[model samples]
Target: MKIRKANQNDLDEILNLFTDTISEVNNRDYSPSQIKAWSSSSKDTDRWLLKIREQYFLVTEEEDCITGFASITNEGYLDTMFVHKNHQRKGIAKTLITALIDYAKENQLKEIITDGSITARPFFEKHGFKVIKKQMVNRKGIEIANYKMKKLL
Candidate 1:
């Protein structure tokens, strides 16, 4: 697999991966309603375009197909991190996070923060992030639980 910065051309693939991962993988931890609400954000094209255009977004591709994607803001806010549902446990997420962390360190960021879903809490913890609090985020009127986590770079 190859990892590189995301471009405008990668938007659709990234959105599909994000929605699929939440619908399939996260469904184990979140209810169906929550999954639908969360995945619905994929339709927000403008928001996604801003991330791809402005953030340190990266995507992993294997055989020309996107397998995973992640992004971090200038302030070290980890806004998105998702591996294709069929590609879980294959180190895609680890590679993505490692690259994001390296970018953070190079940028002289003091820390990295993220709101991780219940299904992703363990993965974030394993990467040296600690939960600051468990918070409920409302999406489309559905309250979903996630952890506010941070890692000092």
Candidate 2:
């Protein structure tokens, strides 16, 4: 797999991966309605465009297809991380996250924070992130459980 910076042209693939991962992988932890509410963010084209244009967004590609993607802000906020549902446990997330962490370190960031879903919390914990709190975030009037996790760099 190769990791590279994301471009606007990657938007459709990234959004599809984001929605698919949440719908299939996260469904184990979230109810169907919650999944619908959460995955609905795929329609937020402007937000996705902003991240692709302004943040340190990266995508993992293999055989000309995007397998995973992630983004981090200058302030060390991990904005997004999604591996294709079919490509889970294939080190896609690890590679994407490692690149983001390296970017943070290179820029002298003090820490990285993210809202990790129940399905993703373990992975975050495995990477040395600690749960700051468990919070219920409302999406389309549906409350979804996630952890506010942070790792000091």
Candidate 3:
């Protein structure tokens, strides 16, 4: 797999991967309604374009197919991280987070933070993020559980 910084041209593919990955991987932890609502953001062209241009967004590809993508703001806010449904647990997420962590450290950011899904919380914890709080957020009228986690660099 190959990982690189994302550009505007990668937006549509990134959104596709985002929707597919979340719908497949997050189903066990999040209800179908929640997943639908969560993945629905993939259609927000403006948001994706802004993030791709303004944030340190990266995508991992295999044979020209996007398999995973992650994005982080300059302020060390880890906005999104997702691996393809068929490619989970093969170090895709680790590679993505490692890249983001290195980027944050290089930029002298004090910490990296994210609101992690139940399925993703363990991964963040393993990467040295501590759960600052457990949150119940409503998405499209569905209450979902997640953890607000942070790692101090």
All candidates: TM-score: 0.99, 0.99, 0.96
After superposition, which runs of candidate 3 have C-alpha atoms over 4 Å from their true positions?
none
For residues 14-50, could you state the per-residue lDDT of candidate 1 as single tens digits? 9999999998899999999999999999999999999
Candidate 2: the clashing residue pairs are none
TM-score of 2: 0.99
lDDT (Cα, tens digit) per residue for candidate 3, span 41-86: 7878998999999999999999988889999999999998989888
lDDT of 2 at 121: 95
Q: Where in model 2 is the C-alpha error above 4 Å?
A: none
Q: Write the per-residue lDDT of candidate 2 for residues 1-153, one digit (tens) a residue.
A: 999999999999999999999988999999999999999989999999999999999999999899999999999999999999889999999998899999999999999999999999999999999999999999999999999999999
Give the range of the ten consecutive residues with the poorest summed lDDT in model 3: 136-145
Top candidate by lDDT:
1
lDDT of each: 0.96, 0.95, 0.91
Clashing pairs in 3: none
On TM-score, who's better, 2 or 3?
2
